[model samples]
Target: MDDPQRSLLYRWPTAAKFDRRVPKEKLYEHGTGTPAVREKFVAEVQRITWAFKLAETTINLAGNTAVPEIQIFEIDAKGTNVTEPVLTAIDKAIPFPIIFEINRDDGETRSTRMVAAHKQLGSGAPKIGAYYSTGWQSARTERQSLPTAITLPALYTALLDPLTPMAARPGEDVSEVAARLKAMRKLEREIAALERKLRTETQFNRKVELRRALKTKQAELTMLVER
Candidate 1:
């Protein structure tokens, strides 16, 4: 289970700040090609701001060919929640990896959360993997200084460390962590489906078969979690 109290609000350096507003239409051009995605943007999103740019020039970090810079986009949401498809559209539009700070205003107070996918440069387009997110926290939450790292890629990994479901092993990179999390998600889904089937299963023989399958999937998930 994800720790709801583990929300991290990074104190972005002044040098790395690039507080620019991003137009929703710009995302529509390439990202929200589908009607459903476009509609989600219009309905759920209030505004998009390109809040920061972490790069070699701005932060004095060494440039990496795979990740030259990391972008932070602050999304002002119209409601308490924005769908994942809306986020997926924005990720599709941007070439670089992005960290999203989603803010929502209720009648009494405002809340914020950090969200991002493990993104990598692909041949045609960036390969965006499963998203990791921190639970909603108070907008007034104290911020922590950015994690120390040698390069942009390392910084990106450090930024996402708090959001991932599982901790990375000694030699594991962000990509490896993402892959493991993805597999875990798949196994979780399978287990849920099997459980649902078991609940409705009537025949004794069918129940036995489902039980066996469920046990196998559960064992697989346990191994992944322990690793």
Candidate 2:
């Protein structure tokens, strides 16, 4: 059986902080510094305050210049008595499905060393998951959409697919899929407003055409989401 506190148990690895330049000798020392202490404080804090454990650390390294960047993605602690690790106000709930990336320091040619990322606007915990699932259900309503939230050939005409896509996927710099989704929503709103306004002004044929288009869109979305 799934753990009841599973939601509290898993979080996106977030709250990243790291010094690009760490003196080898001072490494351990700096690791104990005030900042380091606070970061490490997570452990002690959890011991005294929360009833949770941050079991994973996701690190992503980037940059090629003199300084290299180490991005620390962490799942920290929260709450003291409950089965869940509830995050404090200042402390953030981790993003769902932890993600991050690292790249080699190759002078001019910095190819992909490592890239781990997620798709969707990570809202963290239950809210994020809900948004993700709901978004998919909404998108699935329009399966035939040439330009849908789903990715396809670049040649696919977004104007035809009629749904908004996303922006900045986790690993990639950014994806336009989000943008497409937004655009589709705006278009829908405009159409809806017009329909409401025209209900009294427009004729039956016009309404029929609009209804047909809407049904078609809904059907296509259903196809994409369902299968």
Candidate 3:
């Protein structure tokens, strides 16, 4: 039988950064019901698990139906000093535009505005929206209630619509960010392979060669990172 859900198995190379930096951090703990969320969740799993059987099972399970429409994860930093750190990390990790809602301990919910709304600059280039809003149902205002469900079609529209620009953060060049990410991911894979080879090879000369290759790969990664 043809696997319809195989289409959801897109690669998420940037997810490895989270894996390397925060090894113990649980991923996909909360599901985002939209296809966008499903896509992201699948990528996170694939980034961590190398087993083909596991990936296949996951893909089959996810193919059952649309997931819920939740963002990457929700933070309950209300009245907490660590809110900025949590928000900052989220901003750095997710390049695309998203909406965040902050619910206070008093049962009051206020939105922190959508990260990047697209606007037309006079020079014919698009810019992130200056004004912040509560929800992302439309680009016009911020007072709308949270969406009850995010279908696959809605998620696709949010991402692919050219009229609705999705780049939200300041000074964020989507194409540049994407290119750098691709390079870093490639370097990461090369470094991993070299390290694995180093572990299994006990010959003194081969070990030295592997170490040298590892160092060179690390250096390349560093340069791309520092750039």
**TM-score of every candidate relative to the true structure:** 0.86, 0.27, 0.31
Q: Please tell me which model should have the higher TM-score, number 1 or number 2.
A: 1
Candidate order (TM-score): 1, 3, 2
Candidates in order have lDDT scores of: 0.86, 0.29, 0.36
Q: Residues 59-129, candidate 1: write the lDDT tens digits.
A: 99975666878999999999887778888888899988899999999778898889998887767778788
Candidate 1 regions exceeding 4 Å error are 1-3, 196-215
Clashes of each: 0, 27, 7
Query: What is the C-alpha lDDT profile of model 3 across 1-227, one tens digit per residue?
Result: 11222111112223211222221133222222445444433333222221121111322222112211212223333242122323333333433333333322323433222222222223322233322223222122223322221342233223222222122123334344445556766889999999999999989999999999999999988777662
lDDT of candidate 2 over 145-211, digit per residue (tens): 1122222112122221212123333232223443444455565666576567556646788877777
Alpha carbon deviation, residue 131, candidate 2 (Å): 12
lDDT score of residue 183 within candidate 3: 74
- Model 1 scores a C-alpha lDDT of 0.86
Off by over 4 Å in 2: 1-15, 18-58, 61-173, 216-227
At residue 145, candidate 2 shows an lDDT of 16
lDDT of 2: 0.29
